[model samples]
Target: MRSVSIPDAVRCKVAAEPRVDAPHHPITLSFTDGVLTMEGELADLAAKKLALERAASVPGVDHIVDRLRVAPARTMGDAEIRDHVRDLLLEEPVLQPLARATPSLEPGVPLRPDVVLGTIGLSVARGVVTLDGIVPSLAHKRLAGALAWWVPGVRDVVNGLEVVPPEEDDDGEISDAVRLVLEKDPLVDASQLGVSTRRAVVTLSGVVRCGVERRAAERDAWCVFGVDGVTNHIEVRE
Candidate 1:
């Protein structure tokens, strides 16, 4: 069986999900030879005990990688602090919305799975969201950032998502006319050029040999979009 490595981009989704946090830290999942392993860590004995119970609930896990180190038992005074903190996270409406949306949100794509949308991890007093895990792409990273901004009470997002570059598709092709125009233009370096369309708005980026080449690429792209402006960010190369 082939194993898929979890990308950094998906970490954001993991951090945001309430089910995953469950007091378990650094949950690692791996499947090979028809066997699966799940590992967890926690800050203290109570958390470790809670995490083990939660880990037992996860489906499709064949093995448990237990690395939890038991911390000194918390005093009643400390437990009181924990309760207060938990209450603050639960009361925040924005965090609650995320806590609600995350449970049902589709895994990956438009939104990645590792992004934790819940309030449990958000430090409302400090106005910072502590996120973990990986994202599949920079676009998803940007998407996660945008989602964080939408939350009502959130003043700032502390992004901790690792960016995972998408797999390259080298068999990509461009229209013959566009390719010809790019190749014939002496000012433009066709090799570094990239063309993409969204709602028919053409975007072009890459390195140009000089300023004239950059402008030339823009003109060529304009022909494709046909009167629509092109977002040309062609850098001048020495």
Candidate 2:
């Protein structure tokens, strides 16, 4: 019989995951009252989820406080990040229906306006993007968060966008968004990808021709809101 400390067990799990790149981004784990807190910087959103998944699977671990951050995709100033995020939201075709119309605002055209609380509002300070507003459905909220994550040079995203007349969220909703995003991604072949979700944890399976496609599928899953964990089992074969 072997008794491994909780911290050691978690460490081994994270280190064994090649996607985590544990040596570059060291995760500091602290266990207290059955809650595990992971604090550190990770290379990407995929790595952050992978590390959290590892910690959650460890025996005796109950909850996790994700203090992990993904290194910004690029380096830019506060103003630049804010503008990029705003432009992205305005550019999304699916979100056009939610775009509020104003005096002198043309129909069927999404415009970039100042931060409006009730509608889509945007702000950035110190590389963190804060989205404040109301969306119609859970899919919209998740889509908004994913778009913010796509912006270059964003360290973190605070998804404060509230769902108006709240609707129920289920694994089906998450799966729908996952598939939609993957379909929209030019780098990914969604036709060959299988997506499923349980308890907000998404599992991606099926086959792709290259590692880049496999990684793209995983990233799309991570971008979806309500996704607590992502298991990328998509095999790469040429």
Give the top-scoring candidate (lDDT). Answer: 2
TM per candidate comes to 0.25, 0.76
Q: What does candidate 1's lDDT look like per residue over 95-166, in tens digits? A: 344343344334443422223444323223233344445555443333334343333333234545554555
Determine which window of 10 residues in candidate 2 has minimal summed lDDT: 109-118
TM-score of 2: 0.76
Cα displacement (angstroms), candidate 2, residue 215, comes to 2.9
Poorly placed runs, candidate 1 (over 4 Å): 1-177, 225-227
Q: Taking the tens digit of each residue's C-alpha lDDT, what string does model 2 give over 1-238?
A: 8998898899999999897999998999899888888988899887887788888899899998878888987899877776677666766787776654444235454544445433777778777788878898888888888888887798878888889989888999999999988887788989998999998889999999999889878888898877878888999988
**Candidate 2 root-mean-square deviation in Å:** 4.7
Q: Residue 126 of candidate 1: its Cα lDDT?
A: 33
How many angstroms is residue 136 displaced in model 1 relative to the true structure, after the best TM-score fit?
A: 40
Most TM-score-accurate candidate: 2
User: What lDDT does the true structure give each of the candidates?
Assistant: 0.44, 0.82
